[model samples]
Target chain A: MAKSHEETADPSIYVPSQDEDMLKKQKKKEWKETLVGYAIISPWLLGFFLLILGPILASLYLSFTDYDLLSTPNWVGFDNYINILTSDPRFVQSLTVTLIFVFISTPLKLIFALGLAMLFNTGRKATGFFTTIYYIPSIIGGSVAIAVVWRQLFGRNGAINDILNSLGLSGLNWIGNPDTALSVLIILIVWQFGSPMIIFLAGLRQIPGELYEAASVDGANKVQTFIKITLPMLTPVIFFNLIMQTIGGFMIFTQAYLITQGGPMDSTLFYALYLYEMAFEYLRMGYASALAWILLVIIALITIIIFKTSSKWVFYESEGGR
Target chain B: MKKQNSKISDVIYYTFVAAFGFVMIYPILWMIMSSLKPEVEIFGNAASLVPGEFRWDNFSRGWEGFGGIGFDVYFRNSIIVTTLVVLGTVASASIVAYGFARINFKFKALLFGCLMATVMLPVQITLIPQYILFHNFGWVNTFYPLIVPAFLGGQPFFIFLLIQFIRGIPRELDEAATIDGCNKFGIFYKIILPLLKPALVTVVIFSFMWTWDDFLAPLIYLNNAGLHTVTLGLRNFMDADAGTNWGALLAMSSLSLLPQFILFAFFQKYLVEGIATTGIK
Candidate 1:
């Protein structure tokens, strides 16, 4: 209905004349193409503005006010931010736990992925058999079922301790101890390094065989060839994995939520779990909003840092990057 | 001597991978084995791989689920939600991908940039406000909150992947269709849709996997036990107090992973390829 006005008054825009017939046709085609393009993508367009963009901005606004979802938002500018940044112990605890998890687990997970990928890439015809077996965990790892199993595996008199005691080696209740709880979560994470391993395998394949052959011809050993040829070539993939896993590491929830419940004095209270508790459990939506904003800032900063520093270490084969 | 040494290294490689693979899947094996163990035997001989007697009734007992609701209801709920989610994601993502890959509209690049940025943005940033918005819509504690977003291009990763796939398709097909008097939409329907099958499969498998295993959305929305998905149902097993039915929990937990195992068995090639493509480039 709105376009009716534009259609009726379109003569001024493109006059139909003898000399300008082709040009008019071109203009009309362009207009139709644009219309079709928007029509095709309208779902995403509407979704973005409605679901994602609106909510992101609203959350930002809500972060500055006190809204408990039951009443109208009370404007208390920066109180959430002040208390979170200044004096809140749990906030500090969560931040510390998250940073520790991310910093420690990301590298270990990537390394494990890379090591296994290299092992798988060792020119064996039967390696596909191994990858299939190993990738099962990454598929089902995020489920509550697996998390439940993990809790049992590390329970006080669970299988781990039973096996340890049988071997005359006492094992601590890994999931029940503050000192070892985060390690349990880290192990869970590192164990599911299957997807990244596949990524590394793909990256390894793309490293030209000629490079390895040349290094071998030049009398380079395995470690030397890896360092001189493989590592630098794989840096771009490494950088990608780092950014992704770092983001994912910070968002660790299901494992910690189910396995330890952030227990043993909040030793494993991931940023996400805490934020969830604040919002839904405690009904401090405004403070949680602030915490969520702080998380976004932290993630954005870390991403930017990685990208900025990438120029120093990440080696793209050519400027025309893959 | 040199050949013998190389053969020994081969032996070492095979041994290491085999041993380590066992270590990797040990917990899962422990779980499946424990599912067959009696509750007393599950803990009493927890270190042992074999149970003295198999308690096959655990599966039946676990199938009864907590409260009055059975695992059948949970499975049905998950199947319904995941099916709709997968369909919506594939349909919407393919449509959007076609627009971006084939059409040259003004602001296309800008919108594409926004899509990529959304791919990088954390879900937590929008978690609260989306919850609030859904609450305003009176959609809380409903499957609508879990399934609606899929129809609306909520998953940028799928859109991004499909765009990459659609671009790889030769434009000559579209041009030929255009020459034959096929309109843009006709070309998309006739040419692009059929050709985009592989990418669509990738989309289907991933969307199915994620939605079926999705905990947060279901946790936030489906508070009623009658509507609990398998993941939530399994979580309730853990909530069953000190006299926990370890046998039932293990059995149900193992059962919860059946679909994933089936998918992995049948589509490991596609799954591996999807991971490779999505993870690296």
Candidate 2:
């Protein structure tokens, strides 16, 4: 191994001219590296073809066929797509519910995360402890058990209502009511904003201390310093969080499934949750496939829009990229 | 004048932050407390945060049996599945990430871009077909479906994360190694792998948590009770639609969360580093 290291070093890195023996050794090393690289990447390559790409294309094909678990798919081109778009009321409801969730939850989560990150950045002692406490909810928030606990806490006679009664207030049946069930899911999303908060904290750290000092020396008040210095500097991180949280929010399912089970007149029926119901309960494999494709297009469009708009506001540290 | 206002603001801030913290944690704390309280105490004084009696038996009972099936079996299954998935995700994701990060190849950007697209595709999109594919292979009711994909670089998000981390390592190290006659493979193993410990640990922790917490995959795949993971086992503890043996269920949930919480608490620095490294850049 060390011998190749000695052999391949160009006396002049930019110059290509070299000895024959050294050239031959470099070729041999290149061959070895290629072999190793292939070996290392084979896991992804194998997964790409077998698990990911295969299922994706298969789903596309499955979308045009009437297939159930019991039997082979019979080709039915355009029917699945047509049915979902024109005929399926459930599909429309699911899409509406999903869009509402994405719009509400993503913004709320971002605001919560940004606010917490700002507070923590104010040089508090035991910052790690507070951050960890906030993050623990995120770590376990999506678990089925947590969802069950959510259900219990929000149920008609649950702890939340119990507290309201103690305060001499009339208790509303939260989970049982359609209007409030969606709010519960949104609240769940917001509570788990800790991951983004931590990321924002890291982003905050990256804004040089010197900049704040300079702003302070310039006699800028704290609010001005924050607005002028911190917000602009944190925009990139915020944008990153926005993209990720949007994608994540658009795929919300577990809370819907475990907590409300898409109940109270389908108010909490998340897109993914509804898709699961279609695929499993109704055995609408083809229709579900079509729904999945539509979701993919929606996500792709959102991501593309983000990238397209990024140049206007995103402050890249480097100018190297064309 | 400004200092005094700021102090008042600080007090307001602390109050707001602490109150929100309490609300966020109240359910979790309530769950833990309820797990110790017997069934009668649960509804009798539901608003109370503390249990009247510490039912150590709740843990023992939850550990032993619920609905004629012992949690021991489910616990074993969870451990086995989570451990394997973590090991598999770390090994595969790191290797694949190294390949993407370090190795120059034909169509490299295209392939990496394709992998990125995979990250945006909803997992539910592939759920039906993947189940069909696995079912055809007789993988249902087995750990094969749950555990095997991790070894095959299952989670693209983790791979993307590791790829970013591996990119931050100086390419000069690879060049330096090459000058000393160390091949690309040698550079990856000897030079890059050590540098990726924090990222790899992050992948491991995420894989473990995801697999352990996952309900949909296990719900669809595992038909047998004995083969259930904790997520499935906990769901089964529910009587029909309603969850029974509230104390035991809460106890089991709390117990299930202990492993991940303990791991995170111990290695939090790595988690923080990993989150920053992956997301900030």
The TM-score, computed over Cα atoms with residue i paired to residue i, of candidate 2 is 0.90
Give the per-residue lDDT of model 1 (tens digit) for A67-103. Answer: 9999999999999999999999999999999999999
Error of 2 at A51 (Å): 0.6
Compared with the true structure, all predictions reach lDDT values of 0.89, 0.83
Q: Chain A only: TM-score of every candidate?
A: 0.92, 0.87
The clash numbers for all candidates, in the given order, read 0, 5
> Least accurate stretch of 10 residues (summed lDDT) in model 1 chain B?
B235-244
Off by over 4 Å in 1: A1-16, A320-322, B241-243
lDDT of 2 by residue, A1-322 (tens): 7568567777876454456578678778777766777777899898888888899899999999988778888999899889888988888898889889888888888888888898888896676677878877887888887887887787777888889999999788898899999998888888888888899988888988999899989999989998888887887898899898888877777778878889889998888988888888888787788889988888889889988998887776675222
**Estimated TM-score per prediction?**
0.96, 0.90
Off by over 4 Å in 2: A1-35, A209-223, A317-322, B1-13, B170-187, B239-243
Please give the TM-score that candidate 1 achieves against the real structure. Answer: 0.96
What is candidate 1's CAPRI-style docking category based on DockQ?
Answer: medium
